[model samples]
Target chain A: MTLRTESRFADPDAAYRLLVEAHRKIDPEHGPALDAALVLLLANHIGDPAVLADAIAVAVKVVSPQRQ
Target chain B: MFQFAYRRSPDQDRSSPPRHDVVVVGAGPVGLTLAIDLAQRGRRVLLLDDADRIGEGSRAICFSKRALEVWDRLGVAAPMLAKGVQWQVGKVFLRDEQVYRFDLLAEPGHKMPAFINLQQYYAEAFLVARAGELPGIDLRWKNKVTAVADRGGHVAVTIDTPDGPYELEASHLVACDGARSPIRAMLGAAFIGETFEDQFLIADVKMRAEFPTERWFWFDPPFHTGQSALLHKQPDDVWRIDLQLGRDADPEVERRPERVRPRIERMLGHGDFEFEWISLYRFQCRRMERFVHGRVIFAGDSAHQVSPFGARGANSGVEDAENLAWKLDLTLSGGNAAALLGSYDAERVQAADDNILNSTRATDFIAPHSEYERMLRNVALGLARGHEVGKRMVNAGRLSQPSLYASPLSTPDHDAWDAGPPPGAHLRDVPLGDGFLTDAFRAAGCRFTVLRDGAGPEVPGAAVIDAAASPLFAARYGTRPGDAYLLRPDGYVAGRFRAAAAGAIPAALHRARGAA
Candidate 1:
């Protein structure tokens, strides 16, 4: 099955706010650790390596300086 | 209190020693069980041991259900069960926070529990007591086999007794000596494998506390810093504690009461306990190239060894004895000796490899060898706090289970069955009449058994069990009223068929016995 990029969440803005609020009180040095933890958590939930790799590629393509 | 009587053997003349049908070396749990099983099968067995008494300290504490079943067949399970601690729940902790818990025996209605914790000495004492009751078993203490020579049709062994040294001959010799098997060394066999670098300190302490009967394991905790620790309950108000000591820790200093007491006090919050036994050991995963060498076969730690993390060491050895005993008995009864012994080597080597692989994985996870491994283990433990997937990743110990002997001896299934144990799998115990199916199988001398859904054709020389007696029979067999299963003497399925004739069961039994 293809990876869905459609809006599955009913309210995207509230979900995005909740995701950001989870890291509000973290120290700057621990930011990457928290991000790594969140990535692992979400990857485990997704449960498919192919979809995870595709998601990682798409994120890099959208945010990488060379791609831009 | 365990008491061991020093039974002396009649001195044999130095010129010509007596010959026996089977001579077993080492009177440990494995050797004793094999001797008892063989003698019960009407084989004259001579059991020899270097030590006059049973094992010292609680060397092997965890006995699995398969081991209990084997002991039950040998007529020693009742006393062991009465004196052992039965438990199933194991809790894994990450730095004082519970991460995951497991219940091994989730389903009920089985005779034996998932695991029992008893001292090795108690098991040996019970086995020795049972051995004394058997007629054909000759157990002699302070008799050590110093040399083993495999002649073409027989084996010649040299024994060193307190009186003097003597030479004896037997048709077959079995080595159940410990990891440092003198017979194995005498045979010029090499035990090849890896020896782990880390060491663990095992302390059996006697305390009158009300700790729950469960396995408590920690990756790292406030009481013990930067290492793993495990706590288990045994019989007689004793607790077994294992602390991981890194490669450089001095074993002599770590075993001192002064060093060990503070650690126990920190974990238990009191110093009102006495030390029963303390041992420091490094993990090793190794096995011999072959279990059967001509007429001399090896079992137990003499043949294979694995890390104690999985409780595979003694449990697998007992399985080896159970597997080898019947095959040896049949061979002595004029069956195809070569092919049957060859099957033993093939099956138990596979089991040893499985145990070693599982034990190595558990050891690597518990004591990570590299920084990258440590990082991954920590991440797994950290995520295990809430995530379900991470809980599955934490491997404290896999514990012990019976390994399916997938060998050519098992006849392939002819028809397609939906949901049941496949060929080469152990027979699943189900309620039959007032007892269990395994009880009936054992009552028939554990010979080749023919099980059918209902009575159709008579198979001579095989014990027939009608599956209609138990309600679970139909569900477990996954077949209709006419299907049949031919089982081996060791309770493994040899073959399965649909609408078999009278000769089919006998033919399958011959194939299972490794007849051409």
Candidate 2:
């Protein structure tokens, strides 16, 4: 089955709080490595190449809006 | 809390060494259980341990259903259930938000609960008292094994006591010693596996609190930042708190009350608890290459060890006791020693590997080796907060269960059927008569049992039990009137037949007994 992109949590703030808490203890230089690892883990957990590609495209578009 | 005074035995004064049918080293849960099982089977057992009392601490508080079943067969599950805190619900939280909760025992009608939290000392105490009731068991305290020599037919053991040293010969020697087994060390067997560097502080606190008897786990909670924590309720109004204290935390400093009390106070939001026991441990997943070395056999932590995450250590060890007990009994009763004892090594090794694999995965998730791995773990936890997949992926600990042995002794089924326990799987407890199926199995003595739906052709040389009155039995067994099941003495399904044909029953029983 493909990954669910829409919000599944009952409380969205609770979901957001978990993400913020994950990075509160790490150094700044380790941020990209952490984000990359997160992407890989989430990608595997999602387990669909098509869904991961879609996620990567949306992330790239948000990062470089002018290029799109 | 249980203590026994050491007394001199006749063996110490004998000019020649006395020989025994079975000798079990160490008096922990595994050793005591093994000795009791053998004694119940009418075998004389010499049980020795170095200590004069049950070990201090509330170690191994979680007892699974399989473990309770084993204790039930040994006649000690009643008191343990009475004193233990039984629960099925477990909750996991990510920081301040709870990710999800689960019920371990979803169905009813079973005799035992999903899990019970009882101190290790209580389990050992019950087992020791039961051993005292059996005349076949010779339990000696403060008696240490000074040396062991396997001389082909029998094993020679030298013991040292407070009085003096003595010698004895045993047809079978079982090492139920803890992780650092002196017998294993003397044999020079290599215990090979990986060791996780992360440390955990276990504190048993006694307090009167309103917390439910459920397991609670936190991943990076506000009280314990950047680590994991677990809390569970035990008997005597005591709670067990395990906090992950990174790889570099000094165990000597962390075990002190001043250091442990504050961490617990912050987590509980009060300082009303008193410490009953405090200890530190790191995860080690290791096992001997072979559990059976000639006449000497190894069970429990001496044979294998897993991380404390899954509660597999003592639980699996107890299983080993049951598994080995029957095989040893058969071997002593003139059964094929090579074939029967060989299956014990094969089956228990498979179980140990399964336990090690599960505990290793949980340990890796709990204590990630690198920052990159930590990020992956955090991401999994974050997704768990909102996603069903994340909840399934989180690894607090994969709770212990009985191993369905892929044993050489199991007779493969040729019939196409559904329901009931398959061959080599443990029997599920179902209500029958005034008691349960497990109690009925116990009543059949330590021999193969034939369970049939109704009156069927009697199978020769096997205890027969009729399940005609109980519909649950027919439903659980997926059987009609003539169907039958053959159960091993250790309560595992050996074979099942579509019809209660007496001709085919003997062959299945022969195979189950490892008779060539």
**Clash count per candidate:** 0, 0
What is the C-alpha lDDT profile of model 2 across B1-516, one tens digit per residue?
A: 788999899999999999999999999999999999999998999999999999888579999999999899899999999988999999988888888798999866689999999999988898898999999999999999989999988999999999988999999999998999999999999999989999999999999999888899999989999999999999989999999999999999999999999999999999998999999999899999999999999999999999998889999999999999989998999999888989999999999998997787778778976665676577667656556646766778888978888988888876766888899888877888998888888888857999888877776778988876774888888888888888999988998888735458889988999988
Interface root-mean-square deviation, candidate 2: 10.6
Writing each residue's lDDT as its tens digit, candidate 1 over B409-455 gives 88777677886677878777778878877777778777788888887
* Candidate 2 chain B, run of 10 with poorest lDDT: B381-390
Note the residue pairs that clash in candidate 2. none
Q: Show model 1 residue runs off by greater than 4 Å.
A: A1-68, B1-11, B500-503
- The candidate scoring highest on lDDT is 2
Give the per-residue lDDT digits (tens) of candidate 1, residues A1-68.
35565445554323433534455566656756987898999999989999998777655553444512
- Each model's DockQ score: 0.04, 0.07
Task: Considering the two chains of model 2, state its CAPRI-style docking category.
Answer: incorrect
Task: Give residue B136's lDDT in candidate 1 (0 to 100).
Answer: 94
